[model samples]
Target: MSVTDKDRDILTRTLWGEARGEGLAGQIAVGWTIRNRVDDGKANSWWGESYAGVCQRPYQFSCWNKSDPNYAYLSGAKPIPPREFAQAQIAADQVMAGMVQDPTRGATHYYATSMPKPPVWVKGAKETLRLGHHIFFSDVP
Candidate 1:
């Protein structure tokens, strides 16, 4: 369960891609969601085994999806604005180092409120937190 340099970098990029516009609080929320997934203790987890894996897993975080506008910056094809990336890195490091409280409250999933419709999996699930433009859920199957 050790965090590596690559994990830190990927997690930083993920926060950048997924929540950069939402500011540091939003990025921290996203980071904790990924940390919850990484620490879920499920063997052969579909969510992936590490921070990098969870972030890079296809279709989980939209920024990694090829069609997302942030993909270019997240994938290094384009440079992230310096200040945004620096904030993302701080969020990633703090979350991974257990230096911050998890505002998501053990949430492993979330969706931006901007979605036209809520994703089906959130149906009947426990809503853990709402921050910025996202809604977070736990107890989702």
Candidate 2:
């Protein structure tokens, strides 16, 4: 699917909200996870139809959630720090353009290791990779 400018902006903001502190690799990993969701076919259409759709899909990535702590910054109500935003943009650009490898393998799911407990869905899923604070997974069935 073709990506529009709005899609790129939303994707970059999402990377900024979700993984900006984890640096470039972390941002790229998050981007790949969203792309994986987009490519996941009809089985996961609720994850959305494009980069923007996936990133903005309700309750999937919490940063876009209304109650999420990062909402203000991610939504532009509060500005992201310039350098961090730039780094996230770079990560988003590379991933969206298919210029980088899928560092999380084929992971379509992840949760920050910082979570008090792994989500129930993680059970029996194939563990993919750990990048920064998040643990990636796939093949949950």
Candidate 3:
């Protein structure tokens, strides 16, 4: 489907409770915002491996996690600390918050790029929440 159609579908799903309030569209918007920030090739704009590459596409940066070892490896550094991860989360949250009407139900996750393990809180909310590898958010109020 076209990008416009995909966005419409995502919005519909969110409104109808078929998807979370911070669903695919929110992710896409966040990613797009990050891409714009890093597209200038500024050294400090590097967030992770997924975002290290040029953002020719819009949603490429949304799934990136600076906390991941892979990102660190790519950037020639050790894994990011909790503070850095929190900063990244805040940045992502800021981007997503502007695109989405609701912020209470919006959440983002940062994962270890090289590790195979999932996020720590996945099991707890799996039954009631729509979970993804790097992020979790709810549609219910």
TM per prediction? 0.97, 0.95, 0.23
As for model 2, its CA RMSD to the true structure in angstroms is: 1.3
- By lDDT, the better pick of 2 and 3 is 2
Q: Where does candidate 3 stray beyond 4 Å?
A: 1-26, 29-99, 102-104, 108-118, 126-141
User: Candidate 1: where are CA atoms >4 Å away?
Assistant: none
* Clash statistics: count for each candidate: 0, 0, 1
Ranking by TM-score: 1, 2, 3
* TM-score, structure 2 vs. true: 0.95
Best TM-score among the predictions, by candidate number: 1
lDDT by residue for model 3 over 1-141, one digit each (tens)? 112333332222212221122445434433443334434345654432223232222333322245433444223365434443444444444443454342223332223233477645555542222334234332212
User: Where is model 2 poorest over a 10-residue stretch in terms of lDDT?
Assistant: 38-47
lDDT per model, in order? 0.92, 0.91, 0.35
lDDT per residue as tens, model 2, 1-141: 789998899999999989987999999999999999988878648789899999998878999998988999988899899998999999999999999999989999989988999999999999999988999998876
Clashing residue pairs in candidate 3 (N, C-alpha, C atoms within 3 angstroms): 68-113
